[model samples]
Target chain A: MVALRRAAGEVGRSVAVHTRARPAQPQLHPNPWDTYHHTVIEPRRRLGLDAVRRGMERGEIRDDLDVELVGDLFTGPLLIRTVIRPGATLEPGLAERIVDTVLEGLRPRT
Target chain B: MVALRRAAGEVGRSVAVHTRARPAQPQLHPNPWDTYHHTVIEPRRRLGLDAVRRGMERGEIRDDLDVELVGDLFTGPLLIRTVIRPGATLEPGLAERIVDTVLEGLRPRT
Candidate 1:
């Protein structure tokens, strides 16, 4: 009787452990709409922040740009509108904002 | 006396005509400074106006851009800052002005 009881206890413990086990973490693929839906690009959110961070580390942006970020990424032209439409252009003073965003995005994720 | 007078008159008239013969027109190579010395570019003055005119002829801008210019040339990005300085960017509403300049430059020289 004791042996049977012990076996049941063992089985119960095994089931409990299994119920508490961690589930698989899903791999993240950046969606294009989620990635580039913004009129201006956000490098970090888009997964291209790595290059900006690398560039910041390399001093390309800080050298001529009079500034530096946590990483070595160039925040300026790293995200210029590749195609400014015929009747449209970015608002005045927005380039600097884009530059700032690109640089900040390059900051090493702690 | 009449023959002598006629000969002298003919010689004078001929000499005047020789002096006044149309001066040779100089071949113009656009000077870089002359072509693009402004804060914003002027397409016609730059000697690149020909391309703009051709683009206007093709109707490419009118079809998609909601507007047509003297030339099919796109005045917008065609004159964007190839490099916006680190501390710099264009002023407000200047893009449309640049577009206008590019279009006017494209107007066929009648």
Candidate 2:
């Protein structure tokens, strides 16, 4: 019984000692999804999405050319007013009609 | 009445024309918070927080020197093993005691 116990302890000790003596591998960088997630999606989604959505849903109902949606809300309204910012129109109905048409384009294809 | 209406229309038209003729201001870069938001906080929180939390909470309760807690949940376990991973110990209790101490350190500073 003593011999069996000591042998087991010795085995565990040796395995521990061996592992402790080894050096660590360095963490690799420029990891694939990290690059895309950080550069492309994260910032664009984190900041831009909320900003655009807020502008569209509130106040002046501003709009954009840059629809960086994850899925496809690709075709949304286009407003020269908000995009142009403190922008103007030649005729009032001209801008409104353009906006309505752009919005209609976004409807899911039936 | 006609004069009053015409004058109002003319005011609106001229204001519109004037705004359209103006040049757009270049988007200001290096907006103070933008730098910190993009570089300092966002990336750190987005990747490191999730990774460290996952590594610690899951598989092995891995730990760190970088306790960048927003409010301060500092002082977590120290692992020579999972941190050193596939790692081992001279004495069984050594790692456990150290981990317990580190964990205790995080206990609300109380």
lDDT tens digits, residue span B16-103, model 1? 2322231221113234323232322232223333433333355422222212222112221222122211122334433333333232
Best by lDDT: 2
* Docking band of candidate 1: incorrect
State which docking tier applies to candidate 2.
Answer: incorrect
Model 2 clash count equals 1
**Fnat for each predicted structure, in order:** 0.00, 0.00
Model 1 scores a C-alpha lDDT of 0.27
Query: What DockQ would you assign to candidate 1?
Result: 0.01
Give every prediction's interface RMSD. Answer: 23.7, 25.2
lDDT tens digits, residues A1-110, model 1?
A: 22322332333222223222312211122343233323222332233334333343554332322122211122212221222111234344433333333323211223
Off by more than 4 A, model 1: A1-36, A39-50, A60-110, B1-110
**Sliding window of 10 residues with minimal summed lDDT for model 2 chain A:** A70-79
> Model 1: number of clashes?
10
lDDT (C-alpha) at residue A106 in model 2? 15
